[model samples]
Target: MGRQRKIQRMAAYRRRRAARVFRGLKRRLGWALLGIFLIFQILAQLFYPSYLTLPLARYNREPYGLKHRDDMVMMEQSKFVSTRLELTGSYGKEQVDLIKLGGRLDESANFNNLSYYPKKWRWVPFSILFWRPDVLTLPITFDDKPLLNYTLNYSKKHSKKATDASISIRDGNISIKDGKKGLSVDANKLRLAIKNKYIDTSGIVRLDVPEASIEPSASSADLLHVRQQAEDIISKHIVVSVAGRQEEFIPSKEQLASWLRVVEESGKVKLDVDSQVFGDFIDAMDKLVAKPAGQTIVSVVDDREVLRQEGVTGERVNRLDFEQKMSSILFRPGVYKYISIDLEPIMPEVKTSYSFSHTQAGLQAKLREIGRRYDTRISLQQLNGEGWGASYRGTESIPSASTYKLYIALRLFDEIKSGRLNWQSSVLGTTVDGCFHQMIVVSTNQCAEEWIRQFGRTALNSFLYERGISQATTFTAEGAIRTSSDDLLRTIIGINDGSLAGGYERDKLLDMMGRQIWRQGIPSGTQGWTANKVGFLWDYVHDTGIVHHPKGVYAISIMTKGANYGIIAKITRELEAQMYP
Candidate 1:
């Protein structure tokens, strides 16, 4: 029994001890759990503040399935941080830090999270302990689709395309286009803007995207310089004028504009004029301003006197020199006061003149002098009616000799004109015209006799009488004829002036006379066309015909008795000299 009581006492002591230990342990465990709950609550209030939130009844309604409530709630709560925001763009992204957006970092959250508390609540202790509190207000809201679309549209509207530099010429003008700067959307800036919209929570949701600017290859100043150069060229003018003349050719402004041109040289614009156009202008001026040299005349025979006028020369515009001067003045920049081109003198190659002096009295004196020297009875006359008349026994009748053939030729042509004889009619197996040519040109006696026999002496005498020559009788007195200088000179004048029969007949007779085989007397000293017939009967020599001179045609007849043929030739030469010289 004593042993049982001792064991029971020990058991009682053990139970009391056990009970006390249990009580101590239970109190310690309760304190430990409360401490742990407080710790978890602090952590939740700081890092995981959203974990304390309860869904709103409206949000929990069926078909109101709100997705990402925590993220949306965080975005909405962050809006209370600031009222303004600053946006920046870089590398195609939009960037906005909390500080730049007028917000602060959550220090309680170890700066790993942005603070969305309002300005008044910033000093409130443990303000993060509440989620969706009434004091918290969202100052800004962001819609991703609207924000993205807005950025894209803004980029599209404001974007610029780069332009290439160019240079061109049009209508004698120069045009230049400088390279342009391009603009594009900054994608980095847009991305930054989106990020800030969710994280910064600035009251202003407006996004500003920076544009990238691309510069041009060429500058505007370079293009302007080219345009100014063209303007200067068109405004300038060039004047062309003669040295001493009042006439001047000034190109109009419009014409100058047409003539002006622009060219590119070494990558630079240069002002120039059309060479072909300028050359043509110079040529036209040359034609108008040039003067040709002229010949000088003094007298017909004196070349030395003609040489005296050699100092007189002409002038012309220098085309090449003028072009050079124009180019010098026109291409450069300045006003040209005057451009003078002097005329150049020219020398003549040959000298010539025409002048003479001789009187009819001198011819008469020479004739009388020759008459006295030769002791010949010379009868002479000039039937031009402008000088001395018939002189020195001109009325004295003389044997016509072969000169009677002249009267016969006159009658034959008259018959031909009267149609009594045809020029081609065969007369004794010879053409009448042929026989006439032989009779006149060769002075054939047979041809003359044939014409006389055919036309008859009565017809010849009648023709002479009608011509106011009563002394001429053909084939009478044993086939001999007689005439005076007056009658022969009258007949020659009639033949020369084309009044004997007709112009054709007269020219025919004159042509035959010109080709006379006997050309010693009148043709010897004459310088031009002459027609004459000479008669010689032993000592009797007679020469008479019309002599063509520069002054006029004149009929001269000289019947000489016992005169040398040389004396007659001398007399004829003196007469021609007086008329022509």
Candidate 2:
């Protein structure tokens, strides 16, 4: 009980001491408040009761405490701001990047360098009308030395849209020369030109650094010189390429020039560019003005005159103005238009001459090898016109194939020449499967069979004998027909020489044979222009014709067994090419 009483007495004594300590603290706080009020009153008296008269430096590092500045705030001195900026631009699906630096300038050193900062070397909370949160503070260094009161601003662009940007300076405010303007940069342009010494406001570039940031002194100049050297080294070392447009690594001269021009022009100075890049710029311009690659053509001519017009416009008299002409006269049908005929010339460039006899031998060999190459058989013969022929066994007498039609055509001509028939007396067209059309158009089996019965087999046999063709030549079976190249060439000679018939019958017969539409066997642009008859079966082929070249007309007969139509055409076409070319 005694111990409890003592503990209570001690606890009461501690409570009284705590109360006294609180009273002392209250008295000190009142005195401190009075001192602060007295100091403000003294400051007001010293400045003549006006806040604007206070030195700007006195407000340094102090918050405004919700106070506002008047509209007539004096500009004792301006501050200089420096920056390093970057830009980029896009072309098609490509992007370009560029970099630029600010220039240096001397400023007025006597100006006040003081400002209210939220924290040590941090951005101050200064807003005019509305809040802009993207603003941030930055430290700018020129020639490895930091500058004061310099704020950097950036403008970014992409896909033709521009975004607003601002920057803060870490060092509060410092004195600078008057009439200095800060640079605004667009950060997203690929190419740049800084040729102008002065800034260009209306031009399209990404980055712009003001001239005041760069200094032309010993250390500062050395710093800039090093940067230029580094840039040159980078340009030489770097290789750029755009896919689909170029396979090799190459830089664009125009792109680099654009960048340099912007700066040089801003400063009223000139910039030097690499010669290779200059060449590339010139080449690009040349290509822009050039025509594209495609087909071109002239007109078709016959007898040294424009006979048939195709793929051409304007008057027929304009034929002489063109250097060359093209026609669908060849079997390969299409527009056949081109700039240079060398690509489609019937005769390609040759280094040496070839013999006519050698050409004939090659043609015969090609015909024999046709089936192996093109799955077709073909034959070609060069007759002496004196009735002599060099023949390979399978190519000489491959039956008439369809060549017998030439014989029937000749017979009609013979009758007309004898005054036994008229040129336009229409004969009844016999109807049968494949025969009527074949006789008139293609000369198939049905037509030949029926025609033989009407003409009488004996009379046709006698007709052959009189033409100087071999007695072995005959129309035997329904479709069996036979003739050697030797006999066929003789027939062509007789027709051309006027020995086949006389008068109107001769004219009608040649016209009928000329219009035969067997265009499959012969290709155009041979050693000479030819009027001929061509015949083909499933595996047999023959061409008997007369060629009228610059020299004279000569008889030719080509026959093949076990050959395809494509092979025959190719061989003869090549033969024509080889002989003429």
Candidate 3:
């Protein structure tokens, strides 16, 4: 019994100790839970306190209250407005009305209308506590195609087409039209203005459609001045006459009107006379008043024929002087009643001609006398009927110097006549005719060399041989071709008789020879028209040509060596005196 009582006491003490330990653990766990809840509340207040207005936080504290006040005011005062478009100038006086260009006011806040909201939320921390007003825009909507089509139609209907200033002649009178300004409206600018007024939702809207000015090319006053000047010129009448002519030419008023022309030059308008028509009229008048030149006649005096009468001067109208006078007369209103023209006199160089048949012996003696003074061998020939009539050592060939250029010119013309070449065909740096002119008139060696290079030397020699000029040869000695006096005389005779070339070719060659720049040889001694060629090199000198004399036309060729040009000229003068005296 004693052992059982000891065990019961130990069990009771163990139960009491267990109960005490459980109470201490429960107290510590309750304090830890309270600390965790306090930390969550502080975090919520610092970050997202507005979330505290939910049911959980509301249940913990008093019910969350929101301060409400009807304090928001409408930001845009005047909403309902109208738009007007105006057009000016030649586009016509018109105004277009655009209805409902602005937004309508809504008393109640709606999705489509502009409204204001409070600046802050209900329970947000560190934010405004009361509601503040802010504007929200709601744009008005409308179709733009109708307004665009209406604007374009209005602009087209009232627009004036621009006209350029002009001047014209009708029934011998001048007329002019002045230009006017025009206007055009811009449809794109009007469309943009209408869209802007609706987007802004403003109270009042007024738009002036953009326009541009269209100007004409010419003005009215300028054309009127040109017309007045033209009329004044056509109304005036003048008489023109040539001296010693029975016919009188008075320009008709209609002809005068036809001469007037309106032209624009150098950015300016002008009234001018037609120069070609005036020149034609002057040419016709000149032909009617021209007179043929007189020739000297030989008469027998004391059983000897001698030159008796000197040639009379002929009359011709001066066209250039008459044209100048007419220009002034036409411009003046009452300066002169009529203009009379006087013909100028033309004098002949040779007044008389003598019989060469009777003087042929005397000419031969004179030639021999003049030639004896020079030590060089001299060859001379005078062409007669179909052949040489008189010659002194004329068969001897010598250096021809530049005289070979004449052959080159002949060959060039031959090619032209054969259709292988033309006068205007370019050779080297110049035309064929230009080369011919330089070779004969100016005696340019470069031109001659170029032509000979183009026209082979062998061909030239063949041409000479076929033409029956046997004594002359192609470039043979010292860069100089060889020719005899008789051969040159034959060539001249051939040219004059039209056997060497046609009339046109022969005339062109003769014309170039006549206008030769170096006239110190044969032409210096002649009194009439002389077409000649001269050649010179070192001590060799030669001259050959056809002289148109009062007695008759004849060919002469003189070649000399070791003689100067002065001696050659003296010899030619003596020969001419003997042949004509």
Instruction: Show the colliding residue pairs in model 3.
Output: none
Per-residue lDDT of 98 in model 3: 37
Model 3, residue 324: distance off in Å is: 92
> Global lDDT for candidate 3?
0.60
Q: In order, what is each prediction's RMSD in angstroms?
A: 61.0, 44.9, 42.2
lDDT of 3 by residue, 1-581 (tens): 88999899988888888778777777777877776665665444344322112222111122322211111112221132232334444434565433322222331232111122222342343233232222333234334545566656766775565555544556656666566676666667756665564333333334555677787645666666666666676666677776666677888666666565445578786656667777777767667776657776655432245656767777777766776777677667773358888777766435433333335464554455455556433344454532224566667777786677667766777899889998899875457776677678766565677767777777778887888877445554443578877778777777877887666889998988888766777777777678988876434678888887665567777788756567667776766666666
Candidate with more favorable, higher lDDT: 2 or 3 = 3
Report model 3's TM-score to 2 decimal places. Answer: 0.37
Q: Worst 10-residue stretch by lDDT in candidate 1?
A: 56-65
Which number leads on lDDT?
3
lDDT score for residue 161 of model 2: 23
Model 1: lDDT equals: 0.58
Question: In model 3, which regions exceed 4 Å deviation?
Answer: 1-359, 375-388
On a 0 to 100 scale, what is the lDDT of residue 116 in model 1? Answer: 35
Reference-based TM-score of each model: 0.36, 0.32, 0.37
TM-score-sorted candidate list, best first = 3, 1, 2
Over 4 Å off, model 1:
1-366, 372-386, 472-474
- List model 2 lDDT by residue over 357-402, tens digit each: 3344544544434334554333333433322223344334445756
